[model samples]
Target: MGWMRRAKVARDDPDSTGATNTVNEHQINNEGQRSNINSLPNELLLLVFYDAIQSHDNCSAVLAVTCRRWRNIVIHEPKFWGSILLGSCHPLGKYRLWTMRIGTHSPPRRISLIIRGGPSVYIEPEWIQLFDALKARTYTIQSFHFHGNSESLSWANLRMGGFLCEEIYLHLDDRLSMNSSISAALSEPTWPTPYPPPLENSISPKILSFRQA
Candidate 1:
């Protein structure tokens, strides 16, 4: 529910960085004086966008839809899209549009993805396309969180041999399902042999916390 609420609360804020900018609020909005918020320098605007995005993972759409200038900046800035929130029930058309807008302009980089899926829901083609696209980013994924039943979790095509991800959280319907999924993943030749790299200290503690419904 928190994840869903995040998507809902993300609104386009024209003045995302209220007091952080050198420009004062009055100067930003002087009565009777025409003021174009887009007039801010590109560097400053990017800072604002980054801050907003960091604060709210769902702010990508809000930033892109703010105005043409901001939209262009958001589309071209790979850093602004480092974090992505994917939900199974989220409209595919809308998600596809946003991903295309953000991904086409720059070379893919590491991403922090928070994905929500469930066994009861059908996976959309767009979801598959999205996963493939992210996979093509190579080993740059820094973190991945999957919340779903075994059936839905299996749909996550994370077969790349190596990952830069330091955090991996798998929340599943039960321990049995989780074990089966891990076994299946490990059996895949493309997966790292040791699975999470046997020596990685951070992984053991975090992985043991996997949720069981």
Candidate 2:
């Protein structure tokens, strides 16, 4: 995830030369000699990160760039990345790279790992591809939340599969028919979709919350 630093540098200084800021292994200890955060043990550091990033979709990337020590900690501990954001404005490559942190053999989640789509969601192929690439509940999600317009969901092609999910929550705008929206979301057995035909290998979830806001 050290690559995130380069990505940040490139984004902040897009027109400049392509060279990225090199990571300093001693940066944390050297730069913040008097900082309390610097004194916390590795166990405490994990607790701090979990609390700081539970609401963030890109916790791993954000924490990785803080320092080499923190980056190494996040890379080895996958649970820190359980909460992921969807339909984000970040480039598709970044999302694809993010998925590399999750795998089948990873640790069991005490609670559901969430994937949420914000109001900023674009609902295009890029968004669809992002969800499709998630694999499903077993290799990926356990809970889901989406907030966007109905027309946007018309383009969704999610294929739900893998392990059963605990919940599916959607908050959609009232511009289109509710049936259209739910059909799209319930299409795939594991992935998100608007209105695709029923398929095999699916599990029933607890609830589907559809609200107009």
Candidate 3:
């Protein structure tokens, strides 16, 4: 009878062990929620950061400066630095930094660079700098897009030295047809061989030409 009464008390009293267990469980859950972000597993952290980056192209640069951990992640990961677009809006000061970051990849990954130019675009120097800076990286240029004036025709030839690019897009102004030297260069056996520039606009043609090698 005594043993039976003791068992009944234990079962019926919720304040004895049940309440303590519930409180402990709640505390455990709260601690988990308050855990430090840096305490997260490296793999999971990488996935979270990569998701942010893939969602927005510029997020790669943004996330790199958030904290030391994220910066390290961006620096070590080659995929983040694989593609570079130097448009008219991008600041020229950051170009060297961007190229250097991409240069860190071993056997360097395939890269795509788009250089936006206009009539007075002085991108020949930019191209020379990029080519020189990336030489040691041994980077493989997959595609290069240039948009600028006819004056660049002669100077831009420097970009073709060691470029094993798969595709090249040159959006040069129509004056290229008038200059005999530029016209002759474009007619060479290896130059614009397969892809011919469109002749739609005769006066000041904006030639959106492409060559696949």
Candidate 4:
């Protein structure tokens, strides 16, 4: 009887010990996961946040409000504010914020405004307002590329004031196809005078295209 009882005790001991070991292993794994999450650097975290924001505007705005650190990083990042690629669904308000948020650094060197899909109603006044605002700034904007329905093109605004742009490319739908529109807009008579010719011997054009966009 003594030997039989000892055998039963030995068998129960292994089962109890195995259960404890399993619990311990689980706890260790949880702790390790927490530690790895905490170890990620702030820069890495910021990049993760940027990726999250790029896909959806609502998410971006929400993330921007997550904390002061996130807000500051997103606001100061030049890429966030410099150039905006617009699609057919125009979010004018967002564009306004994007433009306003740009750093004091001169306007972006390249501006690509693409409007795709079938033609939409063209509201001349809003386009005029936006173009006028662009003209009012003193900074030299190098290029403006537009792609979309020709009728939607705001020719009046594009032709307004002096745009310090070196190269302007307009790709339009078949309806308003006219290469002359590009020339006419660039040839506005009242265009602002370009900055004084570079000192008698400047090697670069007042504005040069460093890269093709």
Candidate 5:
């Protein structure tokens, strides 16, 4: 009877040891997983978040509200705030404000205005005002392109100070209709002429070209 009891006790001991070992292994795995998750560098994490936000439009506001860390990165990302694509229904004042914000925040290296929705959608007068402001700080702008109707060129008469623009591309919908007006505007010797005054000695004229298309 005593020998049987000893054998039974030994069996129970091995079973309890096996159960304890299994529990320990599971705990170790759980701890390792947590450590791995926390090991990612902050910059890598930020990049992951940025990739999520950049894949969509109109999600910037939501991205900004995600968290303090995300907000900091999103606000400072130059690509996030560089260009403002004006929509036909966008309010003139709102467009002006957004342009100013982008100029102040990131100061884009290029300004591209696409006016191709239709001829009826004219560049607003407030856009002219924004351009005037941008011209004053023209040292930051490297290239400017206008693709749309000639009616939008009316504001080109505004004078501009010293600017080192490498290129200026003007695409006129009706070149003949706007030729005389554009020529007159360009010829103006006034201080604030229609275009940012040519960056004479700053950039080579050879670097400049005009395309009618």
Candidate 6:
């Protein structure tokens, strides 16, 4: 986070006098000029930010705090916080906050989630709420992955309610399997068609959930 705010400087200053003169000239010429990123269009910046995230070159949080405009763009864009990994060590509402931020509204976004719970995290109450929230927005989910111990597996009660997910991977201990009850409950896909930007008057931003597990 701190590094994002710092400007890079060359260590090989050929001459102290020349460097000072260059700095003075640069400041005089560009004092009122916006940085390259700031000068870019919002749409371009969004694309740049997305590329940076995909390439692991930048973090949204750091980008947001770097400048007011970037913060406004990063915070409002649901995709900026799309993918998430929640573990037993994380608090409850925090998960809820991330989900809320990755909203179900337009500029269609998909989420990839990886949740882990340990033996000590016995059936958290928020587990129900978390799944309920996901269930409600199953249409926005692209991938759902889980890894945890058997004792805590019971908390993973995600209903595929009209979920158009491309992947759903679950693992307990070392074995990979889907719960019979959840599989049996797979009903006819009943999710609403994410209306197109024009169709739903939802023409909006771009976003997708991506996380590091």
Tens digits of per-residue lDDT for model 4, 29-124: 978986785477778866786676555434544556766766777777655544455544444555576666775655445555655443232454
TM for every model, in the order presented, reads 0.48, 0.56, 0.44, 0.44, 0.41, 0.47
TM-score of 4: 0.44
Best by the lDDT measure = 2
Better model by lDDT, 1 or 6? Answer: 1
Predicted model with the maximum TM-score: 2
Lowest lDDT 10-residue stretch of candidate 3: 198-207
Question: How do the residues 100-211 of candidate 2 rate in per-residue lDDT, one tens digit apiece?
Answer: 6755345432222223444445455665555566544345246655555554433332333332455656566654554644433344334334534223555554335555
- Scored by lDDT, model 1 comes in at 0.52
On residues 1-213, what C-alpha lDDT tens digit does candidate 1 reach at each position? 543343334334445454334234444565324345556799988887888887755688677776677789887876677666666445355545655655644433323344554543444566666665554653344556656655554445343223335545665654553344442222222322223442323222124234455
lDDT tens per residue, model 6, 1-213:
322222123224444555556566666666546575578899999998988765431266467678788889988987777555555444357556665666775443333334554544445666555666665653444554545543343344323233345444444453333433222222332221221111122222222221112
lDDT, each prediction: 0.52, 0.54, 0.52, 0.51, 0.51, 0.49
TM-score of 5: 0.41
Q: Worst lDDT window (10 residues) for model 4? A: 204-213
lDDT accuracy of residue 46 in candidate 3? 82
Clashes of each: 0, 12, 0, 1, 6, 2
Tell me model 4's lDDT, rounded to 2 decimals: 0.51
Of 2 and 5, the candidate ranking higher by TM-score = 2
Global lDDT of model 6:
0.49
lDDT of 3 by residue, 66-123 (tens): 7788788877876776555555444344556676676655432333344445544554
Q: After aligning candidate 3 to the native by TM-score, how far in Å is the CA of 26 from where it should be?
A: 30
